[model samples]
Target: MTSLRRRLLILVAAVLLLAGLATGVVLHAAARADRANRPQSGGPAVSAGTVTLGRKGRLMFLNAATGPHRTAVASVPATDPRGGRTASGLTCARFYAAAGTGVCLQSNPGVLKQSTRALLLDSDLRTLRTFPLAGTPSRARVSPSGRFAAWTVFVSGESYSSAFFSTRTSILDTRTMRLTPSLETFSVVKDGKPYHASDINFWGVTFASDDDTFYATLNTGNRTYLARGSLSRRTVTTLAQNVECPSLSPDGTRVAFKKRVLSGAALWHEYVLDLSTLHETALAERHSVDDQAVWLDNRTVAYALPANGEVGSSDLWRVPADGTGTPRLLIAGASSPAPL
Candidate 1:
């Protein structure tokens, strides 16, 4: 071969080899980042991973990652005198487990003239503190760090739901032990319109890791909306409508909420809304799910399926967050399910 041609070939070959090496490096870094950004199974490891649920008037631990899915390993009876079980015969309606802490909400009998309470507990079901709440309990959430807890409920004659319905949502800082009695007093900005309306009501709280930021549902002016709330500014801004019971995914990229699918009916279908794109994807669960959905992981959401549209009884079922797969019944006779 000629010397000139050989030299040119060598240079070209070296350039190709360098480009290949660079591509490999880029691929490796991308893979690592994808794994890092995925939702971790939160909290320390238990035996083969476990989940908690409220069933039969007690808190029970079940399998989270492995087989024997609905089996309960340990339990804390509602009547157990050890923890701060409230005097009103507290029955946990909504339960949240995260950041090594848990919160269980219980309420009085009816929508009006009602009282609710939040029971804060450790990983071992030992009561850390108790916060007595007002209104009829509906939804509850604790931040990923377990430093902030929030809840929402319906009150009589103050909400737009009915002549006898109103709402009260509250947040508590476990780190400082400071509580906001009601989020109703906070300023709200809806569609760029700032308002302080007597008829403004809120429900369904899902917290960000920062604990100061949260997402909730509000009912005002005969319409319901998804609202983003900031504790520092004490304000909530509306984002979308007909969305209720916003549950922030563990990865915090999307929110799983119930969207009313039926016209002139109280029935709702669950959906996931991507926060960045503001796009919503209807989940596979076409049945009316009246409760807030909980994240089993970033890819899966668990929520209770109301039996015959009844309130006090339901079965826990899980659906893919991607809106691709059918819901599989995870636990029977369980109302609320949360991964540990």
Candidate 2:
């Protein structure tokens, strides 16, 4: 064959190979998405039903099972977590509830950027109000009285493990509909003195029942500290270092948080801190937990861990607050455990 013809044939073959690979990739992606929307053979039974935040003796979570209900708010009897799940049509990236109020963070893709918002929900899961979010949602919490709500979002980088990132945390008063656009505007008292830094970032807010006080993770100077915040005073005081995502107990005596095990790394271990003595007790989970824990009761704390052999999913696990018992699986395909 002529040299020009030979080269032409080779180029044509290369284009065909590339076309075949592109087709395969598109097909595979479609198949994966279809599977995600269909119920799995052995997955837990889920059905559409009413989910109320005020329902007593129930446990609510974000369902992660492969089915139509995936990512929806689901509830089961706290006594029987493995029983059939009742799914609420509402979907959220992160969710938390207390009393009769709920805060749901939702994200949707946009042509120019990602659109994010926080929905204030009533007991019946109705959208009472919607607030625009600055970025992707990370953590959410409501005051035990259901009068206050808070949410955290990443303003720059997506992952907390990233070397550098910025977050915007906001608080809302449900009664008056007043909003605190950013917690950074509050005064910071680090180690009892006034503190200020250009790189300070705050996230993972957990509210106290009183509605005036809350706890959150404050990051500055390459270290993370547990900051006790007061909404009435508009101030935050650093309590301890190396603490992130602090969840207050029902009695408000202890905080369950994830402690970084190493510097400059994302690894963390679950721990409970006594507010009176400032003592820390590491839990028995052993695995790295990268979530803000929820106190199932005064004695037990639950958090989400990446599901075994599953991508983009997590399972709810609980451990004793005293740091004595082994970690037990509370829900197979769940995240964001909230007890009502």
Candidate 3:
């Protein structure tokens, strides 16, 4: 070969070798970081008490006892909590609106790295304990009796190509902080494809005051509706339709949810449905709300509504659970408000 051509070939080979080495280094570093920072499982299982709720995106402190006007217990700034981003970063996203004493937070570190961890905090804003989870957590719930905890994890694989695989609901003995293996895992079914997606997600879970049967919503592609599932039986039965975010009454007789309708837009308004007759009623009718509803009690419900037409900016509102009283505003300009 000519001298110029030979030199050009040599330079190309050198560049390729360097590029491959750089790619390998990056992959190795990411894997190492995942292992180093992944959240550890096993918290001193304390007697389950009031559940806590962390608002999605922004940090919100709400006194689960005071109902919603007071200042938040503590707030986490919108930074990545994974340390790979920054020391002050918030790693949890799409946090389910927690509603007992506090909310359980789902932190997604990565799939293979360290699965999501459930961080439970108290009203004083203390770090209660980190509940290590397997797979990516899709939803979490603190039992009403404050004696148990349950969460759903979503697992994805190529075998379930058309659907996502969700592990059966993980029921935790709050006192032990360990998962009960007796309960069967629930999966989403669509067009004959089995999805590991948690049907009990984004406000999909509820527990009875007696800590017996828990209610959740499952999306089977054909329909998204409420299902009453026994904690022990691990069997689910469909109850109502067109409902999302079912918040069972403190008494476990009724449910409060966002009654969705096909508007030109993709938002659903908050509504309450009777579990007995499956009757539907609107709390804020003719109004569109994108936030989840928390039943303060059998008679009261609280949620956030966007004010000034601003997205990601909202005001907390409370209304009678019976759907009769005028909507009252509690906290203004707050993005998320969870009932204590």
Candidate 4:
């Protein structure tokens, strides 16, 4: 009977110790999150102002600096990218704008689970329409004419680095309010033969100047391909292998994309592909880029890379598209770059 009492006492002590450890972990996590929300020292000065996509000679991006304006839509003069920023009061997890239309993907906590949605914005950054999203926003784009918009979300795992994950990509015709809920329903032609697969996943859509044509990453059977899709026909055809997140050039002659360097690894090198020649030119940026690139112009491309020594922050960098010049920092504490 004495031995039984001793065992019970030991179990009680162990339970108390575990409770204390769990409390400590929760407190530490709360402290870290609090620090992230607070404004950091030497951060950029941001003030609320009107941000219009119609305003020419400007560049817009989601501000990543630690402060109240973090994740807000902010803009700087294209002539001076590092100049003072004017921020719109709106916030988003991912954003893209073209010709006067903007797509903002937002998320908020809910009673049961996290709720996500996409907001269609006008040139003045006002919400014109809202659509429910299935998961966390990954990439967003708008047609150059502002008639169409597309967004991708992670339906399963959070990051592309994960070996097993799924994504859902949607396209919207803002003019007619027509929406394609999932790209997977579209017919796929692989290597001049009709292909169908249960494991197919699509993401990182980039629209061409022509409203009917688009480019996106199509992954299936452990391989990724650059797919040229048609919105009118509801079909996509594989153009090249090992291409992810293809961004069509302004001139429409080449596509800037991230090419995976090692199989089953997240490492990637940015490359420009000539559509006519099917040739790829490796860009000068040596870092492993994980974000979909945006063309500053026909000659240059910009992308986001994780900030050095800063957690949960990213910076925008630009490199020449022809694989000539070195990579340069275009904007500090910024992501989702949109040139107006």
Candidate 5:
């Protein structure tokens, strides 16, 4: 009987030890993720400065010296280059620039259960603020006036399980210091009527010059639509169908977006939406681009696409904004093109 008791005690002790070890492992992983977090980057002191990161391929800068390849892109006065400078300790999975402001989504350098944080930076690459995000990072954008910033994250319990997968997109008005954690809170309108649904999700918000008005994509009922939203009125209206990740042109008269087409081979085709006529034209880009198309100028659209279906092998490519010329490779091993 004593031997039996000893055996039982040993078994229970072993189980407890194993459980403790598992807990320690999880805690260690969390710590590793936290190590990658940057509440703020290490940089020189600045009361107020511009982001000086020079054009590093993906992050583009426009100035007087920049000989813009396309006609639609505005020509800047030839001046000293302002981009391509490196930001110390500031690494981003995705980055965007507009109106002298920069937004970056920094992801945990881990393979499993990773997290992301959205960071706002000034023109000098100084950290303005940081917002803890809900899931894995996807997209980030700043308003033309640098008044508003927005981002998207994809959360999943399991990488391959759609049932436990979802996305969160949020916006912050830096000028007013207000935050809209979910666009779902805004009033929804469709076809000139109030629209309501249980599964409405919004992402890829692109602000107009007014900065109070914006465009984004809404997905529900197994379909997506382009939506126009107002920051002042706090409302969104459906504008057109089959549009996702809309990037407004520099002129704000056209939007470059990804549209699903009939061909089953390529998942999406790059297209341009004329805001005045509400008409969309398919671009010459034939690859399946699943990104917000950045306007290099009023007439040139650039976006990222995976090379040869390889996941991490994405490269930047541009097509004519008018959908006339063929798509051409712009940058290799680099993406998320943001003008400086």
Candidate 6:
């Protein structure tokens, strides 16, 4: 009986030791998995050979994996080059070209500045050249080929005058820096004139891959949709309505924009519209969102969303283009995100 009791006590000790070892192994494995899925701690890890522009007017061209680096370009001054329209006060805020190169428009600094100039900068943010504008061009986009540029010019008469406000679409030749002499080929006046604020007031403009065709949103209209225009035909058509912040896919096959759908309290949702069928797939439902989207390849999109109700504390979220998966955060503590 004593021997049997001693054996039982030994067996219980061995079982406890084995159980503790198993728990330790499981905890270690879980920690390893968590480390693997964790987001890297740093700014965008751009791969070798990337050109990026910062919000503070700093342009950097560097290779992350490699040691290659280049600072600011020498030609373009850091000052904002202003031109196009006096009322809009347009500045060189962001890049709009479909090509790898960056194109920006800024109002020149001075008294009595009438027009804004389209400043062509290299990938390194070096000033290559500047194109003067006849009127104030609001949203300027370069074609995929980088050969042509299409922009919207919001024209208001002299500041003191009460003349009607008008907006015209213009296409420019990038190589020659000349406005297409055939004005009728690539231009469009808005459907109806607004009250004509002395300043330019519009969202943005974009050009098709062909450079000749383009799209613009006229806030003055009752139903705001992507207006498709033809340069050769001089015609315009409203492609889709109830959408804002239209961003074309990298392939130019479809466009992603935020559509405000009233879901029990005027909630807004974003949807991706297929240009071929004009069909849309709802991406997300949220309270408020900034109109900025970065296409992560053709199948995915990355955007920033407020964490809870605080806009200052935001996180990077990504969703599949097919609208299959749930919205997931890619990286947290990302107040502002720009896709590489």
Q: Relative to the true structure, how large is the alpha-carbon lDDT of every model? A: 0.70, 0.93, 0.53, 0.93, 0.71, 0.51
Model 5: weakest 10-residue lDDT segment is: 64-73
Clashing pairs in 4: none
Q: For residues 225-301, could you state the per-residue lDDT of candidate 5 as single tens digits?
A: 99999999999999998888899998889988888775333377889999989987888888778888898778888
Instruction: State which candidate, 1 or 2, has the greater lDDT.
Output: 2
Per-residue lDDT of model 6, residues 257-294, tens digit only = 76656532334566788989999997753535444455
Global CA lDDT computed for model 4: 0.93
Worst 10 residues of 6 by lDDT: 80-89
In angstroms, how far off is 52's CA in candidate 6?
7.1
Identify the candidate with maximal lDDT.
2
Stretches of candidate 1 off by over 4 Å are: 1-91, 108-115, 157-164, 308-311
Give candidates' CA RMSD values in order. Answer: 24.1, 4.5, 11.2, 3.5, 8.5, 22.1
TM-score of 6: 0.52
How would you encode candidate 4's per-residue C-alpha lDDT over 3-37 as one tens digit per residue? 99999999999999998987887788777667767
Judge candidate 6 against the unseen true structure and give its global Cα lDDT, from 0 to 1. Answer: 0.51
lDDT measured at residue 314 in model 2 versus the true structure, 0 to 100 = 94
Worst 10 residues of 3 by lDDT: 80-89
**Candidate 3: tens digits of C-alpha lDDT, residues 1-340:** 6999999999999999988887887788787555534432331111222222333343342221111221223243223211111011222433333333344545444334655676655533345667666555545566655566666555553111124444444566655656663243643333344445424332257788766677776655435667676655556666767776677787777888876576333567778887788888787545665555666557877676665643334565678888787887654434333333
lDDT of 1 at 50: 27
Candidate 1: RMSD over Cα atoms?
24.1
The CA root-mean-square deviation of candidate 6, after full C-alpha superposition on the true structure, stands at 22.1
lDDT of 6 at 189: 43
Clash pairs for candidate 1: 155-166, 157-164, 159-165, 159-166
Per residue, candidate 2 scores C-alpha lDDT tens digits across 196-255 of: 899999999988878899999999988999999999999999999999999999999999
Q: What is candidate 3's TM-score against the reference?
A: 0.59
